[model samples]
Target chain A: MEQIIDKYRGDSTAMIAILHDLNAAFRYLPREALEIVSDRLSVPLSYLYSAATFYRSFDLEPCGEHEIQVCLGTACHVRGSERILDALSRRLGIKPGETTADGKFTLKRVNCLGACALGPLVSIDQKHHGHLTIHQAERLLEAYKDEHD
Target chain B: MMIEVKINGKPAEVPAGTTILAAARSCGVNIPTLCHHEALEPFGACRLCLVAIDDAGRQSIVAACNYPLEHSGLVVETGTSAVWQARKMSLKLLLARCPGVKVLQDLAREWAVDTKDLLLTEDRGEECILCGRCVRVCREVIGKSAISFAFRGVERRVSAPFDQEPDACLGCTACAFVCPTGAVKVIEQNGRRLIAPWHSNLEQVACKECGRAVAPLKMLAHLRGLAGEENEQAGEGVFCSRCRRLKTAAAVTALPEVKFPGPFMIP
Candidate 1:
């Protein structure tokens, strides 16, 4: 936390950059880091949380080891992304904002990853899997699970 | 300098930089607003106050709350057919968002927006309209910013940082007072004051006169600090604002009446 704050020289304007670094380091914004930044930057923790929640980039909860992003943008929505999301939710037994109990996978829905050409896309740890059907999505999840085991 | 603007075809002069809502208000032209509060900055979030503005030949529908009356001879239409149509749709969406809210219901009744056919799911139990009043007041007025709007679009909500209890919160009930929907509930339980939705709890201060919980300790301390007084360990509990006001009035009334010399007195 100190190193992250030091990199930004504790300047208030670098809040977003600092949060991004903290999120990247811890996979989410830790409470301890937020408190430290609040004290160091003279900004209230409330303000930090506001910034975190206002922007879609930050997460407050502990993310799973593997991040799964399902795109629900307009193009993807029309292409049956909801079915893919439903399948994933059923298989994982967790909704869009929840992580697996084993901490193996975290499922999330994004507006768009700018891959509209390949609609109904899902990204596993930032690896794009485009034009996915429910069956294909289940297979991909199994592959990841088998790889993990 | 005053800016001459026509609201509903009635010419009115107002100070420059006044918003169309305020301008309409000056000329007694009522423009309904949900997100606009007098104490907080105007947030053009709720489109209930949308009005058609004609600047010379060009015209566009704009949020009356934030649009400034910078230029003179601006034609503002507050209750035009087009404006009412836009406002009706906005009211309908708001009605759907906060299904059972009586305030929205009242607005719907006035606007003739039918909520029977509107799309609604099982009650989400969320009453906040995301007007941003409580958020702005907490930040700008209280300077504590204990709560803020999180997430985007439909998932937007007011909560403490990270949905955790905010340590900096004074539990002043400013959010509860400013909330138009009464979503933020402040509960006093067993010497502890709790602010719901934000999940902030603070020590309660007892009123000196009635022994009732008056305010949170931190809020009292902040107010005392603002009054430029050092923290003194006073043994007696202080009277609440109501009690203090009553005591002052009693003391004033109990004062001896001294009549001034009259110019002429009847024998």
Candidate 2:
């Protein structure tokens, strides 16, 4: 953390990159890392948390090895994404923002992925699955489960 | 030199860079606004202050709070039918997001907006309007970035660090006072001051005379420092404003000159 803050010369404007690097390294922002950043950059902890919460990409909690993001954009909403999300939640036995008990998957709902043309999209580990239904979503989950099993 | 602009078919002269809303208000034209405040910088988040502007034959609708009167020969319209429709639509959307807010409901009623089938999420309670006023005041005025708007869109909220208790909060209640929605709350109980929604528990400073909690400890120290009062003097025991006034009155009356009836005191 000191090395990262020094690399940015402790500039507060590079907060986003600093947070991204921390997130990349830890898979989520830890409180200790945020405190170090705040102290090193002389930025308020509240501001750091605010920036972290403002962006959707930043996560404050531990996520599963395979992160699942369901698109809840306008297009997806119109194409029955809620039912797909409900199905995913039921199959994983965890709602959005919750990780599965086995630590295999974490379900999250995102606003938009900018792929509105392909309505009802899901992304697992940065892999986009577009034009999906509840059955297909469950199958995709099964595939991941089988791969891990 | 003042710039002359026509607002609502009336010519008005205002200083350069004055916002259209200010100019309209100067001309006694009332324009409804939700997010704009006189103390903070202009944040054109709310679309309720939208106005139609015609500059050099090109017309556009812009938020009047941030629109500057920098140009001459500009025609501004505040009460057009199109403006009314846009405001109504914006209010309807806000009504959908926050059906529990009385101010929003009043605005909706004024605009004759039907509140039928609004997308009110039962999980979301009546809370901050995300106008950024509390956050701005906390950071800009108080110099305490103790709270801010966390998350984005529907997930946006005013919170402290990770929504936990804020360490840098001075318990000034600036956020609560500046908040438009009355979402931020400050309550003192059992010698502890709590700023709700953020849940910042601050230590209270007990008044010297009455033993009542007068203010937050940090707030008292900060204000005393700002006023050039020494910490030792404050530590000696501070009185609340009311108690201080009463003590001063008692001391003045107890003065030797007052009892002896000096020449000035004698009728």
Please report the candidate that would top TM-score against the real structure: 1
lDDT of 1 by residue, B1-267 (tens): 888989988899999999999888877889998889999889998899999999997999999999999979999998889999999899888777888778888998888876677754456766989898889999889988777777777778888887878877988888889888888898889878988888888888787897777777777778778888664532246788899999999999999997989767787
Name the 10 consecutive residues with the lowest summed lDDT in model 2 chain A.
A1-10
TM-score of each: 0.87, 0.84
Residues A1-149 of candidate 2 have per-residue lDDT tens digits of 77777888888899999998888778889999999999888898988898888777788998889999999999999999989999999989998989988888989998898999888999999899999989999999999989989
lDDT of each: 0.87, 0.86
**Candidate 2, superposed: residue stretches over 4 Å from native:** A70-90, A111-123, A127-149, B105-125, B227-235, B255-267
Candidate 2: residue pairs that collide = A53-B151
lDDT of 1 at B219: 79
Best DockQ among the predictions, by candidate number: 2
How big is the RMSD of model 1? 3.2
- The residue-by-residue lDDT of candidate 1 on A87-147, one tens digit each, is 9999999999899999999999888889998989999988999999999999999999999
**For each model in turn, which proportion of the native inter-chain contacts is also found?**
0.80, 0.93
- Tell me the tens digit of each residue's lDDT in model 2 across B26-132: 99998999888899888987799998999999999999999889978999999899998888888877766677888998888788876665754452676667888
